[model samples]
Target: MKTLAIVGAGPGLGLSLAKTFGQHDFRVALIARNQEKLDTYMQQLREMHVEAAGFSADVLHTAQLEAALARVKETFGPVDVLEYSPTPSITDVASVLDVAPENAQFQFDYIVRGALAGVRAVLPDMLAKGDGGLIFTMGGASITPTPMMGNVGIAMAGLRNYVSNLHEVLKPKGIYAGTMSVMGWFKNTDETPARIAASIYEMYEQREQGEHVFEV
Candidate 1:
């Protein structure tokens, strides 16, 4: 079976993606900062009969992330799909002025640095295999650039462009890279976990070389 590595596993997107891919028969490796949460998620996946393994590491720690990726590869083989869905927010709705400089730095670190680290951690293996897919979750703030979410918006913009460039660089080698911009909040949508999973499954199934953006 193909393997999928999902970074930043959480309830909203992480677990959703895991469940989605697992249902489609992919051996999934879930990475999160909290061991308790990872264990719980693993249990839930087990109940569904999805092949899964959990790793705990702060994405900010590059060495930890690298080790986790290595473990995943050892267990499930080189990752065929990597989903980066980091939650980059200190306060839910802090104005530009209200957000502390440190908080802004954290957002940038989590969004930009985290994604970069993940790409670095997995790309070498993917490139060697000459086949893989990297999907990043993007928010509406990237295009709209809300003042209240300036830090996040700016970071997303940077990440989106970076992934675009990766797509161009990796396309010739049979690797597909892209972002899936949700465009709005997923919490209130009728798009259930299964539906989201189907969308991702279709994307990977139909992935073409040089494709960069997928606005879902």
Candidate 2:
């Protein structure tokens, strides 16, 4: 079975994504900073008859993140699909006026550089195989500027722009790269995690769209 590695796997969307892909016969590698939570998620997926494993790593630390992906690859073979959606630390978010250089740098490292590191870890193998999927998740501020989310917006926008370009560049190689931008609160009725995961699964299967904005 193909492998799907979720870099920022959590209890909600992460678990849903695991089920969506696992149900489709994809082995899941859940990556997060908390081992206990990861274990819990892995157990839940297994109970549902989904093949899943967990890896502990903090996105902000390149070594840790790369190591986690390395373990995923070692366990599940080259990752056929990589989904990156790490949530930035609260301290990284700053208002427009209060966005100091340090805060901006932290956000950039967390959102942009961290993603690059994750991609680099598995991309070489994907390139050699001539087929793979890359999916990134970000808030609405990434595409639509929100002053209240200054530093985060700046960082996420950078990632969004990069993913857009990556989509075009990787197309010819039979690789797919896309971004999912969430607009409004996901807690609302129209934006449940399971629903969003289904939409993402469709995008992965179709591989025609470069970006999808989940709006409620």
* Index of the highest-lDDT prediction: 2
Best candidate (score: TM-score): 2
- Please estimate how well model 2 matches the true structure, expressed as its whole-model Cα lDDT: 0.91
Weakest 10 consecutive residues of candidate 2 by summed lDDT: 184-193
Tens-digit lDDT track for model 1 on 1-216? 889999888866777788888877888999989888899989999999999999988888878888999899899888899998867644544556667777667677778888888888888988898999998876777666578786677678888888889888888888888776655555623455445556666777777633233344
Q: Candidate 2: which stretches are off by over 4 Å?
A: 188-191
Which tens-of-lDDT digit does each residue in 1-216 have in candidate 2? 899999889877888899999999999999999999999999999999999999999988999999999999889899999999988766668989888889999999989999999889988998999999999988999988788899999999999999999999999999999999989776523338888899899998999989998875
Candidate 1 residue pairs in backbone clash = none
RMSD of 2: 1.5
43 in model 1: Cα distance from truth in Å?
A: 1.2
